[model samples]
Target: MAEVRTKSGEPAKTAETKRPKRADALRNIEAIIDAATRMLAVDADASLNDIAKGAGVGRITLYGHFDSRAALLRAVADRAIAQSDRQLATLDLEGDPRAALARLLEASWELTHRYGALVIAASQALSPEQLQRVHDEPAARVRALLERGRAAGAFRDDTPIEWQVTVIQAILHGASTAVYRGEIAAEDAPGLVRDTALAALR
Candidate 1:
């Protein structure tokens, strides 16, 4: 007869030792992330312990999943980025590149208005390499749209692609600041973005 002994100090294989259902684990992860988001929305300085409590999970459970506050914030930023990605994916850029660039700016302005602080925090916290991984790919897609516009002669042929991208990004930051400072009307955002982008092209 073979000896019946557990390996190391752990219990032997048993039905109870099996992993939780995948859906259940996912639910926990989502719940924790949601809790963190809610906390951050009201106060970006909310404590992790409080967040875990709000999520109805123990501190250990939170750590088991995220390991650190930065990791948790990265997860939250990824969620926000996913939302922006969906919004950007639907833009129609076919007929004219300049018009398309204007439309993209308007779309981006709205997204930044909705999640500016979250985006700013991510930019401030992440290392350059990590930030590039999340932000650069989407940025490149936007740059390609500009390139398309330049090719169509919607923008000045002499304008560098990089300069156009930089100007658009700068305008977005300025718009967000203006909105936060109550210096710009949200209703005027579309026209303002269009005018600013066109001015850059000229």
Candidate 2:
């Protein structure tokens, strides 16, 4: 086995040798993204200054990572998609397709509720083209779940997959808004969304 040496002249472990830590700017970007997500959860209208304050960085530094609020939102969307991708990967769809569909909806509603303002800001403020990669592409995972349910005869044969996608995605969006506005409890939203999806699939 070849022993790797670090810049410090010490033996480099396998993990560290294989994948180095994130660059300074990348770490800062991730910190800012996390701060922005927290701020958005509390204040959907949080400004760049607000996010900067949350991250304990100057507005200029925040801008260095993201040129504009829309740009920041896009980055945030990418982060969300990355996290969501992990969860989607581990899901087992072998059970009842309707139950699986319900689980999918519940998971989406939970994610939306947890990241409500970020979703709202990204959808409304960021250009669709900018969010296409993260926002649009990741939705294909959800569509796959719906397709599986359809193939299993759990979903209505007449229902279009895209229609189901649109409906479920739209409801989750609405549920997020409702949670942000305090019009509905976040805990209740998932159950309601699951019920609605079950009804629609019938």
By TM-score, who's the top model here?
2
Alpha-carbon RMSD, candidate 2:
6.7
Q: Write the per-residue lDDT of candidate 2 for residues 1-202, one digit (tens) a residue.
A: 0111233355456447544533555667778899988888677788999889888888888887688887788778767767776776677656888878777777767676766567666776656674575456547876887787778787886967788778877888888787777998877988888887788778
TM-scores for the candidates: 0.75, 0.75
**TM-score of candidate 2 against the unseen true structure:** 0.75
Segments in model 1 whose C-alpha atoms lie over 4 Å from true places: 1-22, 38-42, 53-60
TM-score of 1: 0.75
Q: What lDDT does each candidate get?
A: 0.73, 0.73
Candidate 1 lDDT over residue span 1-202, tens digit each? 0001121234546425533533455666788888877777556787889989989988987887777788888887778777788888898867777777778888888777666666565566666775775557567867888777777777786867887777877787788778667899878876887798789886
Whole-structure CA lDDT of model 1: 0.73
User: Which pairs, if any, clash in model 1?
Assistant: none
